[model samples]
Target: MHKRSFILTCLSVVVIAAMLSGCAGTMVTPTQQNFKAPVVTLDSMEVAHAFGYWYFSKKVKPTKGKPDNVGAPLDLAFIFNIENPNEYAVKMENLKFTVAFEEFDLNTVASTDTMWIPAGKTNQVRVHAHFDVRQSLLSLLVTGGFQLKAKGTNAWAQLEKWWTGIPEYAVPVHVKAGAAVFKADGLTQVTTFKATFP
Candidate 1:
């Protein structure tokens, strides 16, 4: 009986340890992650609005420094759609993202926020990426493609990935983004395309 109890106790300990590690982000970044696992994928991202004398209807020039107000500086708010295809609820906290304009070497960090992605549904996260507006029409002439990179982690998100049998983690997923197509007057050229998901 003592031997049987000892065996049972050892098994219990091992099972508990396994459960704890599974709930924790041991293999999830701060370690390793499966990027291509597709726990969550970027469904779509759009430049919903253009603020400043450029994209706005008003001809008033945006201010330079206190640019949150239109005519102060040129700013753009992008709408992002993130989808959780898994049945497990995955959450991301204090996620960081960057929209990089490699052609112009301009890059901006997105706003800080937490994203709670529900299972099998799409979550919308809006990021306002800002750039200092020059007095010239330079930004209006920006053309070509850019890259959007985002990284976020929650133990739940990681657990969900592993639950789906993905052993690796994919941090900072990269998506091919077209640059803000614009005309000479700062008017954004309206074009529709799709954002690819991994």
Candidate 2:
């Protein structure tokens, strides 16, 4: 009787072990074969910080001074949601995008920050871009001078509108030609996106 009881216990253990092994064999792993493309979307954009427009000039051009410039610094933050549908964690290597105010392209910004998005989960990335009034005016003149004239508006008018309205969420800001690089298990994917903000 004792021998029979020991044999039954051993058999039960063997059966459980076999079942666990089979389940393990069928379980999915995060590998190149099972990787899925991740999705990126602009969640939100806001004026992080801004100093209203200002200009300064020295009437007496004292030979030792910087050029007369009218400019203010504006900081904008963009938040993006990255969704990973694969069974493995993916790393975002970099992200780049061009910023447009109204219909004019203002500047191109890039973030080299690395982030890991978990499998079957969503992660948020916040990128900040700084724009100077003087620099932005230069860019506008170079890129959109003709367009601005066609619209019957000059750089100052547009810049003033953007500077004041952006803080109040009153202007339309656009994210264009966006590209993000993601990697998982030796596989890489580049995703492109574009969005507009109110």
- Give candidates' CA RMSD values in order: 18.9, 5.7
The lDDT of each candidate is 0.39, 0.87
> What tens digits encode model 2's per-residue C-alpha lDDT throughout 1-198?
999999999999999999999987976666656677789899999799989875444343546766566578899999999998877688999999999988888878899999999878999999998998888888988888889889999988888898888889999899999999998766888889899987
lDDT of 1 at 8: 100
lDDT, candidate 1, 23-117, per-residue tens: 77443331112221213334534333433232222445455433232222434355555555444445544333444332223444434465555
Q: Least accurate stretch of 10 residues (summed lDDT) in model 2?
A: 54-63
**Candidate 2, 72: how far from true, in Å?**
0.8
lDDT of 1 at 89: 48
How high is each candidate's TM-score? 0.36, 0.80
Give residue 109's lDDT in candidate 2 (0 to 100): 86
How does model 1 fare in lDDT? 0.39
